[model samples]
Target: MVLRSTRLRLHVGVSRVHRWLALIIGVQLLLWFASGLIMSVLPIDRVRGERLVERVSPATLDQARPRAPLDLVLREANKPAREVRYRLLLGREVAEVELADGAVVLQDAETGKRIPPLNAAMARAVAVQAYRGVAPTPSIRAILTASTEYRAILPAWRVDFPDRDATRIYVAQNSGRIVAVRNGTWRLYDFFWGLHIMDWKNHEDFNTPWLIGFAAGGLALAIAGSALLYFRWPRKRRRNK
Candidate 1:
């Protein structure tokens, strides 16, 4: 009976230690958890912080090895822009700056829309990114912020008067017209996404210690806990009676 009582005390002692460790480390883990939860709830626009606008889609392209020349692309793109802002080297995409409006245009070389087929090995993703535009390629493919124009919060702001064109515009490189503009809800969404993309800062601070510290700590905690569980925890000395 005495031996059994001693064994019972040992078990109770281990259980008490386990609870104490859980309380201390569990609180720290909870902090990380709470921060992560808050981060998750942070609004996308708040995270994006900017109405990032860039010309990502292509104008006109073919999969043919020897793609049509610039002149041919321009001709197919029809009207010309004052500036052909930037060209995407991968996946057929082009941007044109309209000569008259000084607006940007994005077109798919193949589809002439803002987005192209996903180059995933097995399957092809559809083009929901293909929307009207000075702001083309509205896929979650990437976050965008613009310089020439502004993104307004409408429906949210201009509840009485909803003007789509005034919010966000996607210009066609060839035509220079506001092909697709999202002033109200569209603008709101893009702006939100921009925030979600590093609060739309688009700077070099992505890797700063301030940002990575929490993640690194969490990683360390996870690794340490795993090691303890595998090797050390089970063998820990029992608490003093």
Candidate 2:
């Protein structure tokens, strides 16, 4: 009698726990399924806005311009530069130097003179070089703060192109690098990504405590459901027999 009573208690306890777990984790399970489906349906390149971007061969710096002597530019800067390279910025030969102190300086290669921080015109020119879109000539939309699509590179320029995708390119002023390419497709992917990872703030981390706990609860619920099926099926078979 005691053994039977203990078995009954164990079965009830497992059933209750399984039911509660299902209640807690069911919503997240549905989200996982829906998010996964959306992600799988979209091609990765389109999701990343790569398909909208036209690949262009970068113009060689040393091809036609008579670049200033590298040693002279470094000496003129009067800083211990960690790296130096001659590049054409806005059709003008310039020396891009990165100092050991983490400062990036641009010098006119012809005159070996320091160029000022990029003005609106210069930013527009730099942005134009990086953009290859089927639109009217792209223009500077805004000097971005630490907001919008480019959270990674703050104080970047937002270059707007009149393309069908409403393409916007983020160019970093200091690094002179094309920081991010964004469009409608990427925004949708990012939305689903936030739902999938459950990390809305950064939109990247997947191993948060809440996600882990819900996943564990969902897994336990599935196992318990299987166990319940196993136990109930045999009883039904025995009764039929």
Q: Highest lDDT: which candidate?
A: 2
lDDT of 2 by residue, 1-241 (tens): 9997977787787788888888888888899899889988888877666665533336776666576788889988899999987776767778888999877888988888888766656666666666656689777855656653567555667778888887887766764556688888788878888888888776778898877888778889988888777555655335555
Q: Residue 149's C-alpha lDDT in candidate 2? A: 58
Question: What would the TM-scores of all predictions be?
Answer: 0.28, 0.80
In angstroms, the error of model 2 at 161 is 2.1
Candidate 2 off by > 4 Å:
1-5, 54-56, 63-65, 137-139, 233-241
Model 1 C-alpha lDDT per residue in residues 1-241, reported as the tens digit of each score: 9997876676665556555556555654665456556556655543332243223454445445443355544554456556454344334345443444553445544444443222321010112232222433332212134332333211111111122334333432233222333444344444444333323453223465533554555565565556445543455578999
Model 1 segments beyond 4 Å from truth?
Answer: 1-167, 172-205, 231-241
What shift in Å separates residue 87 of candidate 1 from its native position after superposition? Answer: 17
